[model samples]
Each structure stands twice: as structure tokens, then as C-alpha cells.
Target: MTDPETLAAATVVVPALVAALVWVLPRTWVTRTALVGALATGGLAAALTAVALTGDRPLAGPWLVIDVPGGLLVGIIGAVGLVSVLVSPAYLGAAAGALVDPRRRERTYYSALLVFWSALLAVPLAGTLGAAWLLVEATTAASALLVGFSGRATALEAGWKYLVLTSLGLGVALLGIVLLAAGTPEGGLGALSWQVLPTYAGGARSALVVYVLLLAGLAAKIGWAPVHNWLPDAHSEAPAPVSALLSAALLPAVLLVAWRCEQGLEPVIGVGPARDVLLVFGLLSVAVSVPFMLRPMAWKRLLAYSSLEHMGVVAIGLGFATPLALAGVAVHLVAHAVAKTLGFCLVTPLLAHAPEAARSPVSGIARSSPVLGGAMGLSLGSLAGLPPSPLFVSELLIVAGGFQAGRVVTATAAAVLLALAFSCLVRALLELTLGEAPARTGPVSGSASASGSVSGSVSGSASGSALPGLRGVGVLVAASLVLLLALAGAASWLPASDLVDTLMKGIA
Candidate 1:
């Protein structure tokens, strides 16, 4: 088969088949088989990325396109999906007490997860604006079921809010898509295809209007402020693996479309207007997240804010739109995907060791659980943009790129905000990983006070419930660190290519 066809089948059809097969499998085997399938999918994505990097252009078909930028997102979603699947066994174990019918719920949960995985796969491969929007909405529906899978009252509420709010955003996005389609040369569904739309609408007056409407809807769906009310609640309430996917995959995948839209409209509105709009959205997202990020917070909610901050970083990079900046944006996307997955996965052990600590103030991780503490510390460092972390390099490049683009004020603002965000995250990480575990009274004891040892203290708590030590955790942490190393070198080390040039050429 042809390369484009091969990549499309692997990215889209294979996952759909696996998702269907999951329900019929024995519940005990579901997680194992899903991981295997997800790994294979990730491998395919990596191969596709390699091909795109070497080729002059993306492998495109009638309904799908696999370009360098799109391939990066595809690879990210696939890699994060595999990691989330790997982490799911532990997540399911942590939720065991709350699940009424272990076997049935396991089946239901795995089914939903695979379906969610399949929908994510479809997102980056979508060729047309309408097709991309539909796949994104599909993700919301599939993940909402997984988010509320625990059946807790708050879980249900979070799920409903996620469904309603994101759906509203998608509705708005659809209007923009229809308007964009109307303005294209042929003025049909085909006009909205990524490859064709840019050529025409990039210089159209109507395209400017479409771009504004689309960016607003995308900002909301992607967890930008003023419309981000559902993000923290949903991420906090959902299972850890699902939370990882939402942050690592869904947000980026949707933002990919928004970035492309901005590129297409730049010629029509001029680069300044489009970049200014994105810059405002990006900066506002960064600023609005600060107050929540500064205080003591739930683990998932904190990471949710981190997602918002990083997405803003990406927007700022795109607004800069130089080759160096675009390169940093590419590297940053991969780095954040791997690092954030590690951050979310570490919470599984925390839940198993100190279930109450999920929402409680952080304490005793260093003394109680060395592995969780180390993993979390590294994640915090990476997310905080500490030296040797890819994020530090990525953020630096974006700032430098902004200056080169003559956006001195924007560059200064970005650097300052990043430093502030870093301090807050590092402080929170220190509090969580160090210091004595808070002592709880009565039948429910604390991790530090119970047995003077990590395992025993965790086991002693009634809610802690004796769960097996987390598996494959060390591997996830090790992989994330290695990914950071690769990201740090990616901007300079990548072979001579027109990837960044291609991405920027159409923008203005």
C-alpha cells in the first residue's frame, strides 16, 4: 500500500478495530491487549513522523493529511495514548473500592478508554475543517463517559459540565467552519480541506471574520480562560490516565486546528491582526491560571493549570512565527506531552498510598514513597522550566524568537510570566514531596505517623487500602527524562529541512 494510505489506516482504522475488539475480550485481558495495541499505534506514528521529516511535503489523501506538524501531534497523541494505557491498570486498581461490579465496570471502562483513544487518533489526521471539528466533538463525548466512569456525584457533575461546555464551544466552531467554507473558491466541503483552504481564504475579507470566530471557540474548547471553568473540575474528577490524555493529547490536537486556522487567515487579515489576537488569548490564558496555580491545590487541578500555561507558550511561539520559534514549539509539544503524562501517572501511587491526599495539601511523599516523590519532583522541575529540562529551552527559544520577530514587549512579558509560573510550581512540588506527613487522628491514620515506614503507614490507613506497589513507574519516569534530553537537542540537532519553512511560508 501507499505510504499515506498506510499511515491513515494505522492511525485511524486500526484503533477503531481495536476499540471494537476490546468489549468482546475478557475483562482481565482488556488492559494488556489495549496497551499492546496502543504501543503498536505509537510506533506507527513515529514511523509516519520520520517519513514526513524526510519528505518534501505531507502524505495527503482526499479525507486525510499527514504533514510534518500534523505528524508531530499524531505522534504525540499516540505516544501519550500508549503511556496512558500503560498507567490505566494502576488507575483502575485505585478506583477498585468505588467500582460496584469489578468485572463489568472494568469492561465498561476499558471500552470507553479505547473508544476515546480511537477518537484522539482521528483528530490530527482529519483533512477538512468539518472533519476535524467532528472528531474533536467525538473526543468530548467519549472522554466524558470515561470521566464519569467512577459514578461519584462530583464525577457525574464534572462529566456533564465538560460535555455541555465543550459542546457549546464546538457549536461555535462549526459556525466558523461553515463561514470559512462559504468563502473558499469552490465554496463546498472540499474548500475547507487544510491544503486548499489556505490558498484561497488567506487573502479574503470573510476569512478574517471566520478566523476570529474560530479562535474564540478553539480557545474555549482548549481550556483557555473565561471559558475554562470545566477544565479543572473535569481533570480533577476523571481517572488519572484520562486526565493525562485530556492534557497531553486532546488540548494539543484541538489547538493544532486553531494554529492552522490562524495561518490560513494571516494573509487576509495581515500577520499583525492574527498574531495579536493569538497573543492576547495566549497571554490571558497564562495570566488567568496564575492565581489558581499559586495556592495549595488538588494534583490534577494543578496539572490542569499547567496545561493552560503550556498551551499559551505554544500560542506565543506560533505568534512569533520564525523558524527558530516554530522549531521550539515543535520540541515543546513533545516534551510537554511526555512530561505531563509522567506527572499524571505518578498520582496513581499517591491515590493508592494516601487517597485523602488527592485533594488534601501535599505532604510526606519523600518520607513515605521515594518513587512517587522522585517522579513528581522531576515532573515539577521539567514543567517549571528548570535547566536541563526541555521546557526551559523551549521557553527560551520562544522568547528569543519573539525578539527576533520584533515583539520585544511580548517577549519580555512571556519571560516574566514563565519565571513566575516556575516559582509557583517548584514551591508546590517542594511542599508535596518534602516535610513531615500531616498526622490524621482517629481510625484513619496518616502515611507518616502510622508505622514509621512508607508501606506500613500507607497500608494502615482505612482509606489507603492495601494496594500493590505501582508497576512500570520507574520506566515511565526514565522515559520522560530521556524525552526531555531529546527535546533539548531537537532544535539544533534536527537535520537540514524545510519543515519550519513550510509551516511559516503560508502564514503571511
Candidate 2:
């Protein structure tokens, strides 16, 4: 068998090479090439994850390390990227009518997606804070194109906003990195490696300042509140595949970088302040998202706010930083990735069957299309933390872990906030999947006027053919539901297991 490090490198390289190939390939071959590349990348990532998780020691080096956190995240990025690629051809087909130039769109979109996937795959494996920052900065450029791919006024505006805001945020992060480099006497890139930074800079007087700078900067990119103004618009406007990558892969990958900073700085800043910063951000994110989740909005927009809520949960788990909380973080990250990505993937079918859902909340979906409705319900239900969902299990562990960390007051506040968020989400889920669908303005099929016109029947058939890929969505949704259930069942014993013990050891 190949060594884990080679497998990890291949995961990043194969997609990148495919990206170049797609950029110049004939439009007819783009989808086939993309699918093959995505499969190869996902396979390599899975192999690396298996080694990192099941091996006796982490694979560490000056540039990359496959530790517990990195391994879990590598698996997530791979899974989400593969699913997004699988769904892309369908979404592009359904959206052909809206494109200015379909051929150019195919090449540009696939190339950008591959580039974005490659960058995200590298972030978790980065051994140095500097390397992670560079990888994250690379994502902003590629994803901006994807967010604005539709060429509509709103999409263009949303894409620009995403680019500007995230760029400014990264600027702040760069300043922090410069300060960190300045503080270390060795003063080389190696000094900023996770293993070296803490040893050299532990006693630096400016540690607190660096911590604030790093976390605050990363918050914007992570879509954490106060700085997350770009999230909803971007998610809503981007194509469904891109939205899945953003929510399930990009956001959590960036958060891992932030988590690494916290670990690297903890020795100097002490645990209390480090924990407090994360808690404040986590609480604010949960509190901020509930109102939006309650309001009637487009399906993708609602899921965007839900991202805020879930990211907050993970942050709180990090804030607690106990073994159980860390275990909860692991579970929450994977569960949220699967559930949220499924929710975004369903949007392609949702829009195909009802274009109105792009701008407004949908209803009577279960009544109209049972498969689409069931899939949406499962996705939303998992996100809402209903019974037997892994999110519920993970959130319970996080709150319990908070109390175990002796953060009783913080944990109590978080519990109350989580309950409120859950209620709001459930209300939204009901309104979305079960509420009365808007009354149709078109003539009923039995009406004499409708029965007399063959054009209407032809039109319906054409529209249905436009999204024939929807049948595949049902298969994906069924698989996601089964996977979520298995995770939930496994989560029960996670905190007491050896895996959790390994996670409790800091990422560095």
C-alpha cells in the first residue's frame, strides 16, 4: 500500500491537474473529466483519512500533518466535493436557459470548482498557520467565480460582496500572521509551523493581541456573526453545488484554521480568555441566526442561517475544549456536513419543480412531489435537531461537555439559546415542508379550456425533461439519510472511546 502522505498529496494534486485539463477540454468532455477527477480525489482522501484515524500515530511533517482533526476534515472535504461534482452536471443542465453562453460557463465553472476543491483539501493538512492562511486565500478567488456564475445582477452583486468582505477579512489575518512572525526570533516560515510557534512565542507579551487578531479575522471567513454579512446572499445566489461546497466544506475548513490558532496560542493566553472568545462568538452566532431561520425565506437562504447556527455549536464545543466537547465537535462537523450538503443539493430539484422557490419559501411540496418533499424534510429535520438525528446527539454532548469544563453559566446560556434556535428551526421546517402551497394561477387540468390546448401539455413535458437528473437526487438523499442515522447511533459511545481520547490531544 502507498504511504499516507503520498495519498494526501495526491488528493490535492489530482483535482488541480483536472482543473487545468477542464480549462482547455472540449465542452462535451468536461463533465466526464470532472467526474473522474473527483472520484480519484475522493478515493485518495478516504485512504488518507483511514490511515490517519486508524494508525498508531499521526503523519506529521514540516508542511503537512494528518492528525485526528485534519483526518476528519479531509474526509468531509472529499465527500462534499465529490457530491457537488456529481450534482453539477445536472444543475448546469437545468440552468441552461439562464446562461448567456453555456459552453463557456461549463468550462469556467468546472475549472473554478476543481481549483476551489484543491485549495480546501490542502487547508486541513497544512502544518503551519502560514500555509493554511495561503490555502484559504486561494479559495476566495476560485469560489467567487462560482458564486457569480449565473451572471444575473443579484449573483454578480453577491459574488462581489463575498469577494470584498472575505478579502478584507483575510487582510486582517495577514496582519496577524506578520505580527506572529515578527514576534518569533527564528523569523522563518518554519517558525510559524504549528509545532514550532508555541514553543518560540509562548512567552511573547503580545500573545493576547495576536489571538484577537487571528480569531476576529477568521470569523468573517467562517461566516461567524457580526462579520458574516456576506453569507446569506452568497449562499442564496450561488449555484446549488457551489452552495454545498461553501457550507459543508469551505466554512468548516476555515474554522479548523481558527481552531489551530487557538491551540497554538493557548499556552500564552491561558484557557479562560481563549475559551471566552470562542463562546462569545458562538453565542452571538446562535442568537443572530434564530430570527432569520424563523422568517420566511428562500430555501437556500434559510440553510445559510442554519449554517451559522451549526457553526456556532461547533465553536462552543471548541470553547469547552474538554474531551467530551471535542468528541461532540467531531460528530457535529460530520453530521452537519452531510445534512447541510444534502439540503443544498435538494435545491436543484426544488428550483426545477418550482422556480418560485428561488425567491420565496415553498409549500405543498410533499403534496406535489413526494420524493423531493421527503428528501427536503429529512435534510431539514436533521438540521433542526429532531429525535435520533446526529445533530441532537452532538449538541447534547457539547452542552454536557461545557458543564464538564466547569463553564456552568456559559453552558446554561448556550442551552437556552440552543433550545430557542431549535424551536425556531422546527417552526421554519414545518412552514417550509408542510405549509399550504401557494394557490396556482394556471388553469386546472380538467377545465375545458385547458383540455382543448395541446400546447400546455407539451410545455409541461418540456419543463419536466429539463430536470431529468432529479431521479438521481432521490438516491443521494436516501444514502444521506442512512448515513446520518448510522452516525447518530455511533455518537452515543464516541465520547468514551479511544477516538475521543486522541482528539482531546490538541491538533498540534
Top model by lDDT, which number?
2
- How do all models score by TM-score? 0.91, 0.94
Q: Which digits, one per residue and each the tens of the lDDT, describe model 2 over residues 196-222?
A: 667646354588788888888899899
Alpha-carbon shift of residue 64 in model 2 (angstroms): 1.0
Model 1 clash tally, residue pairs: 0
| C-alpha-based local distance difference test score of model 2 | 0.84
Model 1 agreement with the true structure over 351-434: per-residue lDDT tens digits: 556666566557766656666667788887888888888888888888888998999999899888888898888888888778
- Candidate 1 local distance difference test against the native: 0.76
The TM-score of candidate 2 is: 0.94
What's the lDDT for all of these models? 0.76, 0.84
Q: After superposition, how far is residue 488 of candidate 2 from its true place, in Å?
A: 0.5
